[model samples]
Target: MHRLANPTRFLRLCNMVKPWAMAITLLCLATGLYFSLFKSPPDYQQSDTVRIMYVHVPAAWMAMFCYSAMALSSAAALIWGHLVAQLIAKATAPIGASFTFLALITGSLWGKPMWGTWWVWDARLTSVLILFFLYLGFIVLHDAFDDTSRGARAASILAVVGAVNVPIIKFSVDWWNTLHQPASVVKLDGPAIHSSMLVPLLLMACGYTGFYLWMLIVRMRAEFNSNKIRAIRIRQANR
Candidate 1:
């Protein structure tokens, strides 16, 4: 990680990895979509509506995971003064926000058919909404100050503080009486969902994770290039 901290080294590594990551992301998305749309069996209870889970659940997972990633990167930035860590946190915010939005929209879509309502103030839903706001807040806070480092530091603090919401989002169903269903794919005992459903769900989850990585790498690379161009302009101005 330290070795890759240098911008040049990071760029080199990204160049090497980008093709493979993009390829895998494409493959996973294609396979996952096929499995999700064609192969997966309908839930006994919810029928065709349950199919939305493949997209909704995975987007929800990525939304939380991306924020967690941002929080960890923010922590590293605060402790180690690593610019790459700060850049990663910055790059991840919009992607995570998009995923959160997808989760909410898809969840609402799924809900209307199953729950007869498009929205609810359930604990899990509310907490995830809060998480989405946190992402927006981080992006806003990071750009609020003229001094980039100061803005990054402030955003980092907010990211760390917002970490509290992640677990709440995960356990809200268990911790409170909520309209959201309890854990199905991940549990202490085992996945309660049948294998027919689980396989497509897992594929979708993998696809979403790959998509996140692909976007993150692209965003980070663009950020690095922008910084380089800024540095060159500053040097030219000085001369």
Candidate 2:
């Protein structure tokens, strides 16, 4: 992690790994979609509509996972004063927000058929909505300050603080009676989901993970370059 403090070396590693990440993302998406839609047997209850789980579940997972990542990055930035870490957290906000949005939209599509309503104020749903707002709030707070460093610090603090919502989102269904179902893929007694559905679900989750990595590296590089350009312009102005 400390080695990654050097921006040039970090950029080099990202460039090397990016192509492989993209290739794997495409492969997983193709295979996962095929298995999820065509090969896997539908849930006896939800039948065809269960296919939305492939998209919704993974997006929800990524939304939570990316926020956790941001929180950790924020902690690192605050502790070690690493600008790279701060940039990572900043770049991650939009992607996490996007995944959160997908999860909400897809979950709504899944919910209407099963629950007979387009929306509900369920615990899990509400907590995830809070998570989405937290992401947006981080972005808004970051831009609210005139000094970019001050903005990053403020955003980092919010990211760290908002992490409390993650567990609430994860356990809300179990803790309260809700329209959302309890854990199917993750449980102490092993997964309750069938192997056929599980395989594609895991594949899509892996693909989404790769997609996030690919996006992160690309966005970080862009941020680094932009910062450098800004610095150069400042130097020229001072001269």
Candidate 3:
């Protein structure tokens, strides 16, 4: 982890695996979509519309996963003053927000057909909505200060504080009455979903993960360049 704090080394690592990640990402996506749309059978109750689960569930899971990553990275930044971790938290914000948005949109589309409404104030849905707001709040706070350190610190704190929402989002279905379904794929008990459906769902989840990693590397590179440009400008002004 310490070795990766060096931007050059981190970028080199990213470069080394980037091609493989991209390849795997594309492969998984293609296979996943084929299975999701064609290979896998529809739900007994919901019929063909159940296919939406392939995208909606994974995006929802990734949205929470990304926030957990950001919160952990933010903790590292606050504790060890790891600049790379701070950059990671910063870069992760938008991607997580996008995933959350996708989840919400897809959920609404599915709900409109199944639940007979486009939106609901269900516990799980409501908590996930709060998660989206938390992402935006972190981004806003990160840029609210002129001092870069202050901004990073503020965002780190916010990320840590808001992490409480992650669990709330997860358990909301179990803890309260909700329109959303309970855990099917991940549970202490064996998966409730069929093996055929699970295969495509898992593949799509992996694809989403690969996509996130690939984008993180690209975004981190841009962030490093921006920092260099800012430093050079400061030096010239001082001179």
Q: Pick the candidate with the highest lDDT.
A: 2
Once fitted onto the true fold, the runs of candidate 3 whose alpha carbons sit more than 4 angstroms away are none
Which lDDT values do the candidates have, in the order given?
A: 0.91, 0.94, 0.93
lDDT of 2 at 181: 94
Tens-digit lDDT track of model 3 for 150-209: 998999999999999999999998999999889998899989989999999999999999
Model 1 alpha-carbon drift over 4 Å, by segment = 236-239
lDDT of 1 at 234: 83
lDDT of 2 by residue, 50-152 (tens): 9999999999999999999999999999999998998999889999999999999999999999999878998999999999999999999999987888988
TM-score of 3: 0.98
Q: TM-score of the candidate numbered 1?
A: 0.96
In Å, residue 211's CA in model 3 sits off its true spot by 0.1
How much lDDT does candidate 3 score? 0.93
Models sorted by lDDT, best on top: 2, 3, 1
